[model samples]
Structures are given as structure tokens and as C-alpha cells.
Target: MPPAPLLLLVFNRPSLTDRLFEAIQEHTERPIYIAADGPRADRPADIEACQGVRDLVLNRVAGRDVRLRFQPSNMGLANHIPSAISWAMEHEDRLIILEDDCVPLPGFIPFADELLERYQGHPSVAQISGSNYQNGISRTPCSYYFSGIPAIWGWATWKRAWKLYDRTMPGWDALRNTPWLSSLFHDPTHAHYWRTLFDDAAHPAKGSLESWAIPWTFNLWTHHQLAVTPDSNLITNTAQSAGTNSSGTSHRNMSPATGIEFPLRHPETVSRNEEADAYAMESFYLGSHPVERFFWRLRLPLRLAPLRRILRLARRHLTHPQPGA
Candidate 1:
């Protein structure tokens, strides 16, 4: 089957964009839609970098069915991303989305294509994600599992799902004072972490939005939607330092990008994998909660012991010089 239409979100990062473009070319020659946020006025360097990226992408996709939405002025990430996606969804029913930093594995496009078709009619299945953060643990016996959380490192979704996305998170106002979060997450810590984040996203103090993913996830949860996560991680996020929100830090034991096997062994029933969801919540999102933070601090020394021991052994080896010398 032909691959799903792809929307490549880009900005001033030409190097990352070039790498991701090459990876996409290596995988499939599907119709490409490139959206670039214009350079920020305050950052003089952005002017040249953004133009360079636009030129590079246009030159590379010279002989293809490629579309462009290069913004004239910077919309910022929180605004640009959703708007760009909305623009793309207007043209296509289903779309595979990748950011300039999200380098996909060989199987990512094919995996997304298959799942997009399989779940096209299923309204409850909101998206297909190429990210798996289970630290090598298979959440299900099948090729993919459902989760309440949507990993957007690399993902695909239908127009139906995209239509549900509201950046303001209007539903949070009604559910904030109630037991809605608790009902969704059994663990109070996990619930609390998300509640605080949702509150912030819903009502930004400075009238500035920090993330599009938070509201996107909020929309999924409010609508009781599930995201399909592959058994293997298929997208590697290479924008640690260059990303808007990333702090150049990684999870303690997150899984790395790997290819998914063909002829997917799908789950018999479409249901959320609670255990997997909980692990992700704790490892990725809940780390900032006061209680979770305390516990993580307590465990930090223990988690570093193995690395410390390795360093000690290396020092001893260097001091003794007993092997080849």
C-alpha cells in the first residue's frame, strides 16, 4: 500500500532538517508537506538559518509532489505547530507528522501507513506513535499497544482526531475541581502532576503557551481517546539542545529508536495498556512532582553506583597499566 501523506514540521535547524529529510527519502517517496515557522525578529541568526532551511528543503524535494507552508512571521512553536497541522489536515484525511529533529527508522513510515489504514474507522484510536519509552519492555504481546498518553516525537493521526484538538483545553475548567483526573489515573501522584500541568496550559499566567503537546494530550484524555504505540521505538529525538522545551536531559532508562517488524501482530481488543501508561507517567511526566522528586533524589545515588564503579575500575586500570603495556 502507498504511504500516508506526511507533514514535516521545520524551523531554523537546517542540519537536523537535512538529516530527517534524508531519512524520509531513504524510507519512502510519499507526498511531502513541509511547514516552516518563520524566523523570530529578535534573533538575528534565525533570519539566515530559517531561509537556508527553506532553500535546502525546496531544492531537495525539487521533483516530488511536495507542498510548502513557509510562514512569513514566527508563530512560535505552541501556535505554529497546531496551526500547521490543521492546515495539512484540511488537505488530507490522514497524515504522518515528523518534526525536523525526529529522525525516523526505516520501518516508521510503513508502520504508520499500515496502522493508519487499520484504524481509519476507529474513532477511539486517535493516533499512531513511533515512540516507545518502556525501556525495552514490551507492553503487549502484539506489535502495538494502546495508551492514554500520546507520544508525539513522531506520530500519525486522522483529521477526525486533529479536529478534536483545542489549544486552550476548555475541558480542564470543568474537570479541575472534580475527581476526573483521579478517575483517569489511579495513582494520586500521577494525577496531581497532570492536573497541575493541565491547569498551567489552560490558563497561562503571562498569556503565553509553552507547549502544544500538553493541550493535545489533554484533548485526548478529555475525549477518552487512545494512542497506538509500536512495540519498538521507531523515532529518535535529536533536538535536545536545539528544541524549544527540551533541557538536553533524557529519561533514566528510556528505550532507543529501533525498527518495527512487518506483518504487525495487532492487539485483539482496542484498550489502553494501564501498566505501560503508568510507567510512562512516572518515568517521564511525574518526575517533577514533590513526592516523586523526593523519591527520585533518594534513588539517584543508587542509580549512579554502577557508573561510579565503572569509572573507578577505569582509573585503576589507567594507574596500573597492566594489560597491554
Candidate 2:
């Protein structure tokens, strides 16, 4: 069977968009849809960059089965992406989604395609993610594992799943104030962090925040759904600073694009990996609180023998006081 159509979300980043588009061209021949959000009017160069990105797609992808959706005005990531995705889903039952910054490995296309078909109408399966943040630890024996945390670096979902996406977070008021909110996350810190995010997005009293993925994630969790992730990462998030909202960088969570050899090794049972999910909560979703960061710093020496040696030398120098003497 043919793979689901792919939808790409781009903004004023022609270089990154070109790299991603090339990756898609290298891997699969699935029908492609491109959505380019308009440039911010304040930035004089934005319009030129945005147009360059659109032209790059048009010129390079000429004669291919491609569709373009260019926004007339800047809708920002919050509005542009979800609306573009909804528009793409109207033409197909499922879609493989990518952002300008996300570059897929060779296996990513097939990996998402297979799982998209496998979990087609399964209400419990929320999304199929190509990115894995396990830091080389294989948490499950299966080729793919399940978790409630959805990774959007590279992913696929069905119309059924997308239909549940709530941008306004309609039931936020009741859910936000409930005791049950804390129970949803394994760690209280994560619960608090997510609550803050949901509260900000829902009310936006400061008019500074706007997003769709947080609400979409909340929708999936409320419905008790899981996302499937590969044992090895098949996608790379390359743009952490350039034209992106992602803050900070980590050695553990970021993986280089690597291929997954298939006819896929399917899991014997469909069950969520609680350990993996908790790790995601503690490690990725929630920034290390003061206590967690302290613990991590304490554990660093043990994890790295070189660091232990350096610390010991420093301690000995301080205790001996040889230089001052």
C-alpha cells in the first residue's frame, strides 16, 4: 500500500526547508503538501525569505504530486501549523508531518508509513513518532515502544486522532483545578509545569503565549491514548535556535538521524512503557527543578570517570594547600 501523504510546515527558513525537502525527496515518493506561513511584517527581510522558501519548493518539486498552502499573513506557529495540518488531513485519511527544522532519516518514512497503517482506526494509538529520546537505552524488547508523551520532531497521525485536537482547550477550567491533574503525571513537578502551560495557553491573559501541541497532548492524555516510538531515532531536530521556538539543547534527548532496517520487528503486545513515559516526563517535558538538577550534577562524576578524576584532583589540591604554602 502507498504511504500516507506528507505535510510540511515551513516559515521564513529557506535553507532548513530545503534540507528537509531534500530528505523527503531522498526517502519516499509519497504525495507532499507544503504550508508556508507568511513573513512577519515588521521584519523587512522576512517576506523575501518566505518567498524564497516557496520558490524553492515550487522550482525543485515541479511536476511532482505536490500541493502548496501559503498563508497571506503571519499566523505564527500556534495557528499556522494546526490549520495547515487540518487542511492536509481533509485530502487524506492520514498524514506524515514534518517541520522545516526536522530532517528524517532513510527509515523514518517507511517506519511512519507502516505504523500509520497498523494503527489506522485504533482509538488508543494517538501518534507514531520517528524521534526517540532514550539516550541509547532500549527500554522495551519490542522494535517499537508505547508512551503517553508524543514526540513531534517527526510523526504521523490519522484524521481520527487529529479530530480530537482541541486548540482552545475547551474543558481546561474544570480539569486545571482538579486534584486529578496531579495524578496524570508521574512527577508532581511535571504536573505543575504542564498545568502552568495549559493555564497560560487557555487564558493567555498576558497575550504572550499561543500553542496547539500542548492542548493536543492534553486531549490525547484525557482520552487515554499512547504514541509509538522507535527503539532508535529516525529523525533529527537540527534547528534549536535558528528560526525556532525550542529553548536550550541537550546531548541526551537529541539524536542524529539514523536508518531503521525493515520489515519491521513488530511488538507482541500493544502496551505503554510506563518507565519510558516517566523518563520522558522527568527528562524532557519538565525542566529539571532545583532538586533534580542538583541530583544530576551529583551523579555526573559517577556517570563520567574523567569528571570524577578531575573533581578528586581539585579536592586534593584544596585540602593539601601546597601552592599557597
Candidate 3:
């Protein structure tokens, strides 16, 4: 079967865009939609970098047809991303999404395409995420499992799902006061983590900090939609210091993007994988320990501070050469 339409989100990251586009060379015949945010006037280097990204995509990327949407001014993440995806869906029923930093494995596109078709009309299935952050734990007997979390490093969704996205998170006002929000998660701690995030994202005074994904995730959870995730990760995020939202380094930063075997094994049931979801909640979403969770809750604003400190310590350890070395 032909590949699904691909939508690539890029900004001032030509080198990363070049690398990611090279990985998509195998899909030379696939039509691609490239959405690039305008360079920030404050950052002079952004002008050249953004131009390089456009040049690379137009001249070098091996695709049959290319569509470009370059913003005139910096729309930032909150505005650029959803608008771009909406633009793509205007031409196609579904499209695979990849940021400049998300490098896909050989089977990532096909894996997403298969599931997107399988669950096209299934209201419960919100998306097909190419990321699986279970830390090598086998969460399913099938090739993929279901969860409420939608990892967007590399993912795909249909028009039906995208239509449900609320840019302003309209239900926050009603949901924030009720027990409905907490009941969605397995524990109060997870609920607290998400509630804090939702509150912050929709804060009237802090409106500028609003991002698109938190609202998308909120839309999924309120509707009780689940995302189909692979048993193993298929996309490795290589953003590092160049990441738009994230910085510093950690054990989870660069997991291998291993290819999936063809002829996937499908689960007979369509229910969410509770065990895997719990693992993600504890390991990736919330902290495993109560004390750690408390600190994480406290560190939301300064989350990157701890990561920077950890990276510094790691550099020191490496440079000093431990006793064994």
C-alpha cells in the first residue's frame, strides 16, 4: 500500500531537519506537507537556519510532491503546530506527523498507517503513537497496546480525532471543580500531576504559556480515548539542547529507534492496557515514589533546573574519571 500523507513540523533547525528528511528518503514517492514556523526576529541566526530548512526540504528531500507553509512571523509552538496539522488534514483524511527532531525507524510509518486504518472510525482510539516509553518492559502480547497517553514524538491521527481538539480547553472550567478529572486516572497523584498541568496551561494570567498538546491530551482523556502505542519505541528524539521545549539530558533522552517486524500481531480485545498505563504513569508521567512525586509537583516551573544540574554532575563524573576507570 502507498504511504499515508506526511506532515513535518520544522523551525530553525536545518541540520536536524536534514537528518530527519534523509531518514524519509525511502518514502520518495510519498507526498509531504512541510510546515515551517517563521524565524524569531529576536534571534538573527534563526533567519538563516529557517531558510536552510526550507531549502533542504524543497531541493533535497526525496518526495514526489512537496507542499510548504512558511509562516511570515513566529507563531511559536502553540499556534504553529495545530494550524499546520489542520492545514494538512484539509487535504488528507489522516497524516503522519514528525517534528524536525523526531527520527523514525524503518517500520514507523507503516505501523502507524496500519493502526490508523484499523481504528479509523473507533471513537475510543484517539491516535497512533510511534513512541513506547516503557523502558523495555513488554506490555502487551500483541504488537501494540492501548493507553490514555499520546506520545507525539512521531504520531498520526485522523480528521475525526483532530476535529475534537479544543485549542482553548473549554471544559477546564467545568472539569476543574468536579470529581470527573481525578476519576480518569488510576490514582490521585496522577490526577494531581495532570490537573496542575491543565490549570497552568489554561491559566488566564499565564495565557502566553499555553501549548497545543496539553489541550489535545485533555480532549483525549475527557472523551476516554486511547492511543495505540508500539511494544517498543520506533522513534528516537534527538533534540537535546536544540529541543524547542526540552533541555538537558537523561537516560530516556535518546532511546534506540528499532524497526518493527512486518505482519504485526493484533490484540483481540480493544481495551486499554491498565498495567502498561500504570507503568507510564509512574515512570514517565508521575514519580514512582511519594516523595519524588511531591518534588516533581513542586518542580514543574523549574523542571529543567534539576535536569541541568544532573547533566552537570554527569559531566563532572565523566571528566574526573571514576575510581574504576
State the local distance difference test value for candidate 3: 0.78
Best by lDDT: 1
TM-score, cand. 3 vs. native: 0.85
TM-score of each: 0.85, 0.84, 0.85
The C-alpha RMSD of each candidate to the native structure, in angstroms, is 7.7, 7.9, 4.6
Pairing residues by index, what is the TM-score of model 2? Answer: 0.84
lDDT per residue as tens, model 2, 1-325 = 6878999988888889888878888644678998989988777788888899889988877888889999877888888888999999889889999999888887888889889988897778989999887767788666789887888888999999999998888888888778766776656655665675676667665433456787888888888889999988888887554666332212234755556777888887778887887777666653323343333334332222233244445545555768656
Candidate 1 lDDT tens digits, 93-180:
9999999988899899889999999999896999999998786888778999998999998999999899999888886898888999
Q: Which clashing pairs does model 3 show?
A: none
Model 3 misplaced stretches (Cα beyond 4 Å): 61-63, 204-210, 243-254, 287-294, 297-325
Q: Give each model's clash number.
A: 0, 0, 0
Q: Write the per-residue lDDT of candidate 3 for residues 17-71, one digit (tens) a residue.
A: 8888887878757788999999887877778888888887778755458888999
Pairs clashing within candidate 1: none
